[model samples]
Target: MTEQPARWTEATVYPDMWADPDDDPRNSEGPSPDGELGSLQDYLTNYRLTLRMKCEGLDAEQLARRSVPPSTMSLLGLVRHLAEVERHWRTWLTEDEPLPKLYGKRDADFDGAVAEPAVVEASFRDLEREQAATDAALAGYADLGERVGKDGVAIRELLVHRIEEYARHCGHADLLRECVDGRVGQ
Candidate 1:
């Protein structure tokens, strides 16, 4: 009997991360209705979901594996980093009674993202809790244009910033995951 070589395309299982729009769960059905807050919130929600989706199905070791040498970026690091970011925004919104950070000092979030089941689990928990808290804080504001805190940052700016943060990190995640196991996309 003659042996037949297996057929393979390239790095990933699928030709592209999003080969079929209709079947791609990551595709946001469309934009949120016509309001500013509604649209901004929808974009923020999608980015947050995208980050989480990128880390899905990976074990602690894989999640904590550094993307490249000389950098501490990892999927797990991003989760912890985002959790801290959300906590910071929450504190900003509640200026009079700011909450303590999840990871004290700068960059501690990424520095502490070690390869452990507990850490991975806690990172996810913290991210979820902080995200909910941030959302709750935003919910209290009726107007996105309203100035907030001692910095006088507008609520709209903060919301938009969060979306931008998530979008940038999600792009990093795409490359990291592809390097990790050739598994790509949502």
Candidate 2:
């Protein structure tokens, strides 16, 4: 096995990152949307892509590697956690009754994140499924001011909240990705 540096190398595959700026997949894919809703959608889309980009090319073990002591956070854990977030939020608007959490009764999302290919695969599958479901739920709302859920939170507020959620976690993914293999990107 290659010797992991004292902490990490000053350079890696992309000379301190996994991919070059020219080839970075973080590049937004289509025309920028044109207004408040479009802007929010655009930001959310980019951040989602960013989180996935950060996890790319990692093995199941690396993806599940813990970040620092006392923290169960991992790329894999983040995926599972976000999946739960997506599901919980969507159900607030769609379901008449509360649904059981997918992972566990406790901190199952992170705790259950293990260094197994199957776990990694399932985590991502759940994430994708939940993300799509949440998006579909949001689509039913025409106005950002439209209130939903028990708290009666507005759709715009929820969208903003989701974006904030992803942004915060993506930052964690950045540090975790770098710690895992010294890969970094913007």
Candidate 3:
């Protein structure tokens, strides 16, 4: 692992502490209107945003740096992988038939992840776009009990799963970001 700077600066500080008011979901003071589903969505959204915040201001090399040796996973790769994941889940939930995978190869996400600025920017953009689409698709369903997904999974289950996925990745992001610059916390 490369040594990180010991001091913190505006560029190295965690962004979540000073995030835009509109994006600060945790600042809200009450239960969500839609109950469990809304809570899950809120958690997922915040976690995803936090992941992005963790990578903010980092250059392509830093973003593409793997925290541990022998692992191809990087922040850029995670963003790309999550974009594909969000698309896959949304398509499965919305359609009656099983849709083909976005990347034909199951490991295409990691395979395509590279240490390039354009690729990193594109991956982040794809993630934001897919996230927006997934949010819109989820907005129409009021009943969390409604069945979605090809295997007849309940909407609530899927929602919870999304939250879990984001939470898990957020942890990874924290470690990766710290490894890059030594900044930590939400």
Residues 1-186 of candidate 3 have per-residue lDDT tens digits of 546655343333345343445555455766565867656877887788778788888898888887777887788778888888888778657556645555558777766777898888788888888888888887888898999665777878778878888888888887888778877656
Off by over 4 Å in 1: 1-14, 18-23, 28-31
Q: Highest lDDT: which candidate?
A: 2
**Which whole-number lDDT from 0 to 100 does residue 101 have in model 3?**
52
Q: What tens digits encode model 1's per-residue C-alpha lDDT throughout 47-157?
A: 887787678778999999886767899999999999999988876674587677788877889889999999999999999999998888789998888998978889999
Clashing pairs in 2: none
| Candidate 1 vs. true structure, TM-score | 0.85
Q: Candidate 3: list runs displaced more than 4 Å.
A: 1-26, 29-34, 94-104
lDDT of 2 by residue, 1-186 (tens): 456524343234456554555666565566778889989998898889889988888899999999665899999999999999998887667436766798977689999999999999999999999999899989989899987877788899899999999999999988898788876655
After best superposition, candidate 1 residue 120: deviation in angstroms?
Answer: 0.7
Ranking according to lDDT, highest score first: 2, 1, 3
Please identify model 2 stretches exceeding 4 Å from their true place: 1-18, 29-31
Ten-residue region with minimum lDDT total, candidate 2: 4-13
